[model samples]
Target: MNWMDTIENNNSVEPIEFNVVKVDHNISLAEAIQLSVEKSGYEVEFIETFYGIEMDIKIPFLVGTEDDMINVNITRDDYTITIDIDIRRPNTIEEKLDILEYVNDNNGFISFSWNNEEELSLISIWMSRERLDAVDMLLEHRLINIEMGNAYVNDDKELIQEKLAQRGELEVYRDEDLEFNLSGEWNATHGFEYRYILRDINELINAIQEERENILRFT
Candidate 1:
């Protein structure tokens, strides 16, 4: 589902935080990025750094200042590569839709904040590439609504669904066993409000990788 429908339908809301997705380590960071940008009708130049590689991927329609471009940071550690993209400037509706569609087609996730004008506001989409040789990515690292929350697993609907499917009843409780623990509250209108916290995000990412069978699932 798209953001507009989801935002309008939700009775209550939480603060929008950065979202992350993981893919396998297949192509080099440089190559994968180059292909992604060039295929999107943008050109990229990589700057090698002591820590890793950096690139400012430029979209023709998005060019104005350096801050308007998409900044990509790549670093390799522990047999996996992480690529983070920060959209420095606010994107138009069309641009946002195009970028989201492209990333989804490429088996990646894009996260960003939304200003819905109504009482609803927060938005984040964490679409993980469930396979090997895929890039692990997070989008929109902007910090907003600081008082609301700062945990990554705030979006725990999927986890809740899995539990319900297995147990036949919603076990609404704090699952400390998971790297990301979930806390629950009873909402009179919404029934149950579950908040997910990233107790150890790294552990979650590694576990996702271990659970992936192969790239064929994605293909």
Candidate 2:
């Protein structure tokens, strides 16, 4: 069965575990990056510019039923790989704090910056060649974080919670454990939303992994 069918057939109550493909550490950083993206079923593009030749790759993620792209740039110097996703500026101090906290929490792998002139918030993931195997996981994480950033932009509390839970930043209660009070509070009424969000997130993750596996299988 295909990945979607696999997701549909998944009945286990455990978290999904992904298999890491072994990468050759002896290879040059550029070659390692090229191999990793290629193995994940993405094409590596070489573009000529005034500075030098640059490597670029575009990966897709799902937003509702629509697809969005995340651009990854790989450079040889210092073996750095940069992933960039632009989000809207936060409208409130609370929103700004939320974004800052998320970045600080994942500071080892992510950083946030705002372009006041451009009126945009930039979320970036940086990694060295040593963590080459983590590229896929980081890509997935970045996409979820982008969704969270946009959630803040749109002032979507439910979506923000869902994204935080997906990243394990927030606690999620089991269906049986949720105690609903009659006050119609946010937690009481929306506690069950996370279950559905988790289900969708799992499906999206599985779909991405399947796409990579299919690409590797034929190539």
Candidate 3:
């Protein structure tokens, strides 16, 4: 699909024809933001809603203070990049997510969602995984399968044995703690918790970008 053409069709959105003859494609966030607002003579705000990304930049009440919660802090390890996003809310998350998702191309290995005494916190850090990337991924999905091998036996099949049968391949990892692996037995199945581990996605993308140049700045 021609995304540019699609954006042009929207009534609320229009394009800005800038003299990109010498503009660097990789402009800094602060600079790009400045240019975007400058294009409107500081009258209109700029937001990019391309693809699945939605972001908006609006001028404050010209004097009154407001909270700017979306903050991205990048730190460096030996061979990993930890982009810690201080998430506030979904609207807050959208801004940072859009920037990082665009920069990383939505290929972070370790993607996780959890609240850290904050609002709708979703932090994703990318690291370099070793030779176990493939196996780890397989195991991850397999674990999910084992957990949900049965779709509420009491609610549907009601065949615990059939559901437990799916754990044959995971016999090696089976044990007392994993008694529920091949068995449709839950440790009191009441609540469901969905955790997002962004490290895995980050590592996957980082490994894919192993040969690419990246700025690993330390602060």
TM for every model, in the order presented, reads 0.27, 0.37, 0.19
Write the residue-wise lDDT of candidate 3 on 1-219 in tens digits: 311121111122122222111243433222343353456444322233221112232323211113211111111101122334333333455555543543455343433333344434434333432212222234456632335553331122322233344434334334433321112233111101000112222233343233112211100
- Could you give candidate 1's per-residue lDDT for residues 72-188 as a string of tens digits? 444331112232323322237764564455344543332332233333322222322111101111112333222354322334334333333433222322232211111112221
Q: lDDT for every model?
A: 0.31, 0.36, 0.29
Model 2 worst lDDT run, 10 consecutive residues: 177-186
Tell me the deviation in Å of residue 65 in model 1: 5.0
State each candidate's clash count: 3, 0, 19
Candidate 2 residue-wise lDDT, 82-127, digit = tens: 5444544666776566556645664442233333335555555444
Candidate 1 wrongly placed segments (more than 4 Å): 1-27, 63-67, 77-219
Candidate 3: minimum summed lDDT over ten consecutive residues — where?
188-197
The TM-score between candidate 1 and the true structure equals 0.27
Q: Which parts of model 3 have CA positions greater than 4 angstroms off?
A: 1-104, 107-123, 126-175, 178-212, 215-219
Best by TM-score: 2
Candidate 1, poorest ten consecutive residues by summed lDDT: 130-139
- Top model number, lDDT: 2
Give candidate 1's error at residue 111 in angstroms: 8.2
RMSD of candidates 1 onward, in order: 19.4, 21.1, 21.0
